[model samples]
Target: MEERPNNDTTISTDEINVLLGKLKFSEEESVQIMSTNDGKNVKGFESWAVGKIMATEHPNREAMYRVFKSLWYTKEEVDFVALKEGAVIVKFGCLEDRSRILKLMPWLFDKCLFSMVPFVKGKNIASYEFGLSPFWLRVYNIPIELMDRQLVVAVGNAIGELVAIDWKDRNGAWTEFMRLKVKIDISKPLRRIVKLVSRYGGETIEVIKYERLPDFCYMCGLIGHTFKNCKDNREGAGINDSNAQYGSWMRAPFVNPNQERNMRRNGVEIVKTTITANEDKEESQTNSRDESGQSAQKGNEKEVKKARYRHHLWKKEVISLYMTAWDGLSIRGSA
Candidate 1:
């Protein structure tokens, strides 16, 4: 059997370095391998043979170092780690304001983005982004730049407070309800601090597994497709070309009838007034027709009563004529 090289074997610094160099040490791994007890037991590791052994699995420290140093890049390049709770952790990471995030989006795709959001839908949730966070973070498909500054601030504040409320509520409920899930919100401030230090540099994401947006089949509630394309009752159908994400295949929010009229006239108020007037006119006509029908019935009844009264009066003999005849007869008899 061939003799195995020992870790205690004495090896010259130059020989060990040569071996490490051949292994293509990353800067860090090179530092480690080189810093070992002055090449003790690193004999067989002194050259290409040594490099071949280390190359089987371990990273080439020298090679890594050369790449980083040559690029003149700093540890900041890879300093990002994922939030512990993933999306929920994102709920906690807040910015000084929300607009700050909007401004950072383009750069976020290019670099790392951090910060907390406290409130989401009245629940306290927090989130963090790996440098790899995508464009889905855009608010309503409208660039933060296009939105009113006040709205951006409001949305940010609201998101922050939302997560806070939910987190607190869940915590409270969890304490009372033993069966309630125990939550995990991992934030390694210490890790960040340590990485920020001179020792362990920041590291970029080594991997990503993506899950595409869902297809729950709702039109109006900001899901899958447009209402015109909806399979449900076609009550909310119409083309909404004016949508902010008009051509985007991701989401389709079609404008309904009233909206279409508004677009046709280029005025929302017009549609509202027209619809209002039409409804009011129809209601009034219905009320008036009912009233007129009642009045006509009453008129007919009055005419019938008058006709009957006249007939009765016509049927009555004239008492005055009889009286006249009697008086004349009396006068003749007397003569």
Candidate 2:
């Protein structure tokens, strides 16, 4: 071949330094500034909300848009724009609509939590963090007397930020469990229990249950993924249902209190009818046996007393049913 120049020849250190030194920067080119009036360009986005759906798999943007539009029911039109990594930006038609949506925080889509925060001016949509999410926790094992605002606040703050307390019919009425609206850090493992210490130095372990809870890792107790896909579980020895710390117990059961009330009312009526029928049958038997002897009369008295005792037990059972219905009411308070 004929002599050819080596195109792959490396540049020497001194030659590179000389080439770099040839470049110059003027004072005017040192820094670039924008006008202060740039703020007005993004003023319209002040009422916007930016959020992300906390799910391992990306959510269906179109389905989510439809679901939120239907669920919000805003008087004015609302807009949704899907972004990368399950992130979404919402534009409300009016300030009222924006405020209403934020008030209903911790919304769910296909049972996955959609955590959101108010959009800030000049802030990048991806910069917003969705670490905190609001959840309604039904605290069990708390005494009736201890189900006060102070106790709820304390317990709520222990798990996360105390958003609000669901004081649904809590005016001196007993409930199966106290309901608290807490802003929890979903980045960490969900708190399964809280220990309470009385002023007398007595300790009580209270079980925490979440209402409308989404998918979570049973092995690691973290939200967003299940035990089968948990990274921590994969990195260590395998875990199964028997050895997992968290289970289905973390999710609270959904019960419609109104429906429960109606059912219990019908139950009470049925018990009343049964008691009436039993009493009528006993009276007829006693009348038939009246002419038998004094022994028969005494036996009827014993039967009457037994019937009365049974009636008393039924009344107590009716009361128990009513109480149970009220205690299982849905935690409607949100913030």
Best by TM-score: 2
- Candidate 1 residue-wise lDDT at 193: 8
TM-score, every prediction: 0.15, 0.63
C-alpha local distance difference test of each model: 0.27, 0.68
lDDT of 2 by residue, 91-129 (tens): 887766776677556676655678889888777665788
Off-target runs (Cα >4 Å) in candidate 2 are 1-43, 169-174, 235-241, 257-335
Worst 10 residues of 1 by lDDT: 47-56
* Global fold similarity of model 2 (TM-score): 0.63
Most lDDT-accurate candidate? 2
lDDT of 1 by residue, 1-335 (tens): 99887765655556777897678657776564334555433222221000011011223333332332222222222112222232212111223222222212211100112222323332322221222211111222222233343433333332221110111112332121111011111121000000111124533211111112222222342223334444553665544556422223432233343442332211011112223435665555567668776654454445444543443342222212322332233233233
